[model samples]
Target: MVELTVREALRDAMAEEMRADGDVFLMGEEVAEYQGAYKVSQGLLEEFSPRRVIDTPITEAGFAGIGVGAAMAGLRPIVEFMTFNFAMQAIDQIVNSAAKTSYMSGGLVNVPIVFRGPNGAASRVAAQHSQCYASW
Candidate 1:
């Protein structure tokens, strides 16, 4: 078996997805021009170019909504939230917009987007994970 680090695995997965589908694109804070917040997406911009791997502002809700809309419009999006805390800023978009797009469209439109973010220690909230259960 190939021994790969967590970052390598994630990078490979994203790369594979992007390669398999041209519509699949990743956008979020630091994803491009910064190599990701945790550097997991390092070299992706060079490999996929800036259009596929994009960087955005600190506004999660705005970008999350954009991702959802893009997905509804037939483009696959990979939305990175940076962390659960950051995701909190887009909880409504994730739940209401992305999650319910198909239902709201009468089972017609499909929001084929992937939502990603850091977990556990990234949040730095020890023993407070359960508090996010309801929000998630």
Candidate 2:
């Protein structure tokens, strides 16, 4: 068996998927030039270019809504938040729009998107960043 950190595993999986499908792209804050907030997306920008590996502003809802829209248009989007706590800012886009659109459209619209990020507590982080929102 091969051992890999969570970051490496995620990067490898995304890279594999992107290599297999042209529509698979990754988007999030600092995922490109910054190599991800936790370095999980290291080297993806160089391999996929800015077109596939995109960096967005701090507005989570904005980018997430874009991801959902792209998914509805037949693109597979991977959205990475800096932390799951911040994902609350985009909850409407994730839960209401992306999660509900397929049923709302009677299976005519399919949202193929993935939202990924670190979650729960960590050492020396701010209080707001330390709370676990995964179970909520």
Candidate 3:
């Protein structure tokens, strides 16, 4: 058995999927040059190049919407939000667009994408950044 950290596990998953299928790619902020906020995509840009591993701007809503569009168009895009707190800006894209597209389209479209990142509070992050709204 290979032991891996959460970041390493996520990186491996992305790499393996991208290698197995050319349609799979990753997109999000800090996912390329910075190697991801938590380094979950470390070394991926080096292997897959910028075309498959896109480091988008800080516009979460824009990038998230783009990812949903890419998914609906038959490409498998993995979207990272840095943290769930920031993802709130793209909730409409996720819930109304990505989540409802397949059902609304009667399976005509498939959103085989994954939106992942750290959720909930971390130590010393304080109220603004540490708030946990899992129940909300």
Candidate 4:
């Protein structure tokens, strides 16, 4: 058995999937040049280039919505939120759009998108940043 950190596992999963499927891509802040905020996407941009591994601006809502739209268009997108707290800014796109699109479209559209990142508490983060919205 091999052991890997959460970050490594995430990177490996995306890498493997992208290799298997040409339609798989990733987009998020720090996902490219910075190797992800938590380093989960380390080396992906170098390997896949700007087209497959995108690095977006700090506009979470805009990029998150774009990812949802891309997924609806038959591409598999992996949208990363630096932290779950930041996800609140794009909740509508995630909850009402991406999550419900497949059902609303009667299965005609498959939103094969993964929205992920470090959820829950951060060791030194403050109240606004450390809370876990999943429990609520």
Candidate 5:
């Protein structure tokens, strides 16, 4: 039997998808230069180049929108939110742009995207950091 940490499994999935499809790419704060805020993106930049693994500012809504737009353009985008709680800032985009782009566009646009979040704050934290990733 083989066992893998959540981070490992997520990384493997993203890596495989990127390798299989040139249209698949990952982008988020600290994903490239910082190797992901949680280290889930540790070796992606080195393995796939900066073009496929991108780094952005700490603007969740902005990046989420960009990811959704890219997905609408026929590209698969993986977006990481430092914490799921903060994802609220971009929830509108996820629900409207990423999830319903095709329906809203009368099936002309399909948003193929993966959204990952709630990282580095699962214990004794407060406020938005108090999110539960029970089965993440």
Candidate 6:
């Protein structure tokens, strides 16, 4: 058995999925060139190329919406946030758009996407620098 950190496990799962499906791709801030904000996307850009491993500006709503749209188009997208606190910027796209698309379309439109990020607060961080939204 192999012991893997959460980040390593997440990266491996994504690599496996990408290897298994041509439609699977990953996108997020620093996910490509910077190796992810938390280094969770370490070597994906090299393995999948820029076309599949994409980087986005800090506009969470913009990128998350793009991911949702891609999923609606039958592609599997992995959308990573530097942290879930920033995800609030894209809550509309996540809850109203992606989460509702299938039901709103009567199961005709399915959004196959993954939203990943570290949750909760880091120890010893400033109050404004940490947030926990697990209850929500």
lDDT of 6 at 8: 97
**lDDT of all predictions, in order shown?**
0.86, 0.95, 0.87, 0.89, 0.85, 0.93
Number of the top-ranking candidate, with lDDT as the measure: 2
Q: 9-118, model 3: which lDDT tens digit per residue?
A: 88888899999999999999899999998788999999999999998888888999999999988899999887768888899998999899889999999888788777
The per-candidate count of clashes, in order, stands at 0, 0, 0, 0, 1, 0
TM-score top scorer: 2
Q: Per-residue lDDT tens digits of candidate 6, residues 39-125?
A: 999999999999999999999999999999999999999999988888999999999999999999999999999988877878776
Sorting all predicted structures by TM-score, with the top scorer first, yields: 2, 6, 4, 3, 5, 1
RMSD over all Cα atoms, model 6: 1.2
50-101 in candidate 4: lDDT tens per residue?
A: 9999988888899999999998889999998888788889999999999998
- State in Å the error of residue 76, model 4: 0.4
Stretch of 10 with least lDDT, candidate 3: 124-133
Cα TM-score per model: 0.89, 0.97, 0.92, 0.94, 0.90, 0.95
- Model 3, position 57: C-alpha lDDT score: 85
Clash count, candidate 1: 0
lDDT of 1 at 88: 79
In angstroms, give how far residue 115 of model 1 lies from its true place.
0.7
lDDT of 6 at 99: 97
User: Which residue pairs in candidate 3 collide?
Assistant: none
What C-alpha lDDT, on a 0 to 100 scale, does residue 107 get in candidate 1? 92
